[model samples]
Target: MNTGNSPLAAGRARLGALSLAITGVLFLLYPLVRPYADEKSMQGAEAMASPAWVAAHLFGAVGFIFLALGLLGLRIALRETAAEPLASRAVVVTWIGAGLTLLYFGAEDFSLNAIGQRAVNEQNLKLLVELTEAVRYNPAAITVFGAGLVLLAVGVILAAVAVWRSGLLPRWSGVPLALGFALFIPQFFGTPAMRIAHGLLITAGSLWLASSLWRAQRR
Candidate 1:
């Protein structure tokens, strides 16, 4: 078989489809299952310290990992298409975004877990607030984290543009996913229901894109 028609390509297609689907599911679950509490307040300390908190953030980190892998597969699938250039760019941006975002996620997962646990044990609400602020507001940390999210938004947007341009796939397939990423930063300020709704949006986008890509491969 020609290299382009090899099993590897099919494997990648399936993997990408599965990865996208999984990413959507994970993202939805992250906010859904995470313990919610006002992190700055004494009453909320236990929620932050709980395993659920770490697990919630970890869902996001893992989802990003899946997204990066899915994009790589998508780039391969888009090869020779009009959208290839944009898909290529999206791959790079998404990968870099995943890396930078993961760094902050790591801190959130481990550091906050530690801090919350210690604060709970010592009954030090002030210490919890102070240390959490110090970590979150660190100039370098916050900047990189912010940049990562912005880049991720850009990446998804680029992917959406590519999908719109690709004749082989449904033009609107990427829209919901793109919208979810675009609103990611703002969603934190929204109500819990709003966040959950955002998760649903991502899931819808992922399913839309995955179905289109999968069908393209079948044809």
Candidate 2:
């Protein structure tokens, strides 16, 4: 009869879990969809125009959407539980950082890819090359995107620590969640393997949180 125990809450938990899981999988597959090396070259533009590359951008956009929704659900679930002040603040940071990161990526993936595709179709090799370089090595873009990722990672780590200390979620989940964010360091340096590992860890943590929320609802 309680709002927390309502079917709607249970459904939200399930949705959150599924979204996080899918987001992880999509991130894992990012390398496949990403442009091959020498992307700023004519060869790269040609490759970007390929069906696979376009599909990858589309998939990445969808993944970001899922990630945004998953993080929103996570924030709601955490708020529903009684948390320490630190944990509550961490939850807010987590959702804000997650939302910003997703928004940036969603727009970049969709719009940039569309531009690249159109440039290729129109035989604007010069424009395509310039755009590719900007996307890959533009200082401003790199800084902004990197900052967002760092914020998101830090927020996750903080939230995990709070959860661990506060028992808002299972203590076991917190450790891995923190570790997952720690792995983001390697990702920041552009290490492919670390990116995949980070995705796996975050996925595991999210599933664990979702399970906890579902159990809480039943109780």
Candidate 3:
């Protein structure tokens, strides 16, 4: 139960700190390289068919995974501290968020890629729009996806709170990261440029926090 000298535990702690840096880079690239267009048209289908589309979505999915891992690492680092409870809750919420987010990303990346390929092969671009709508509008898929994103926001906010009160870490370390997650859903309505900017914000925030976590681990 003590885990004080557990090699596996120590490894996880290290990886968790490193995960934030990886997540930051991936999140920054997700939107920048993504093929963006009006997804309701032929051009949209073409964009979807491109390798970049899949790569972009995959980046997002993988980023979420690493983000959750990083949060878990943070929780471990906070163990036995006053902030432990909040960090633990943050990990749970973020893990759930990452799971839900990945489900939607799976549909977006793989399913849509298939649909795009099929549409391109058939020379019937309308299929891309139709199929995409059907899949995206699925009640269950959307509900969970929405919930997941919101939970991500909540989880990060909790992490920020924990960091703020930790007394062992910089109070401002989690602010930018929390703000970035909080804006995740609303940014969907923004322009492509705005999305890119959003990515930058997340990148900065994540890297900042990652620096703190890395230092914490070394101490």
Candidate 4:
């Protein structure tokens, strides 16, 4: 009856436990790394330029490293132990997707914030109005945004499912994944209101995952 020592169980348990800790770190540091914007524009922003944002981004990046570890643990838990390839593949995909998305998102965070600050100043108004015009004419920023969004979409879908099925963490973790996925649509709709909503949803999900990871570690 000593199920605690079994590798499979231990892996699953370890993943479950580690998830809580990883998620907790992510939650705590997310604000530091997340993009900041003009309260008026809500148009979109990043966390660069500002010293505080830079510090947060650095801290948040470290948190993501922990999250990646938790995800790898989950992958270990799901690997070939069961007679199913599909399940294992899904877990692997999710782990990879999440990692890629996390990295991309971090980059986007700094880039967007830097861009935003350049466009605006302490007055909370657009400083470089010409830059906005340039951004409109140039497709680079749009392309970067699109790539980040796509990665986020795929990552959330895959990770949500993996977390739900792994039984290594609370089912609630899936809620944030689902919410985060759902928020992506608004990001593309090109509406300020939508971005705000999306931001809230994403923030909620990030915190939930962090919490789940932290709780897992405690056990």
- Angstrom error of the Cα, residue 195, model 3: value is 0.5
lDDT of 1: 0.86
Q: Tell me the TM-score of each prediction against the true structure.
A: 0.95, 0.70, 0.93, 0.54
- Residue 162's lDDT within candidate 4 is 64
Clashing pairs in 1: none
Clashes of each: 0, 0, 0, 14
lDDT (Cα, 0-100) at 139 in candidate 2: 75
Instruction: Please identify which of the two predictions, 2 or 3, would achieve the higher lDDT against the true structure.
Output: 3
| Number of the top-ranking candidate, with TM-score as the measure | 1
Cα lDDT tens digits for candidate 4, 1-219: 111334555555466445535554554455434455543352443334456666665655555455445545544444433312433454455455455545545654465456667644553435434444454334664555455445545545555666666555576775665565555646645454554555456556756665664454345
On the 0 to 100 scale, the lDDT of residue 128 in model 1 is 95
Candidates sorted by lDDT, descending order? 3, 1, 2, 4
Instruction: Report lDDT per candidate.
Output: 0.86, 0.61, 0.88, 0.51
Which lDDT tens digits does candidate 1 get at residues 1-219? 121435678678778988999999999999898887788775578888998988899998999999988777777778767788999999999999889989988988889889998999999999999988888889999999999999999999999899888776788888889999999889988988999999899888888888878777777
**Candidate maximizing lDDT:** 3
Which 10-residue span in candidate 2 carries the lowest summed lDDT? 1-10
Q: Rate residue 156 of model 1 by lDDT.
A: 90
What ordering of candidates by TM-score runs from best to worst? 1, 3, 2, 4
**Between 3 and 4, whose TM-score is larger?**
3
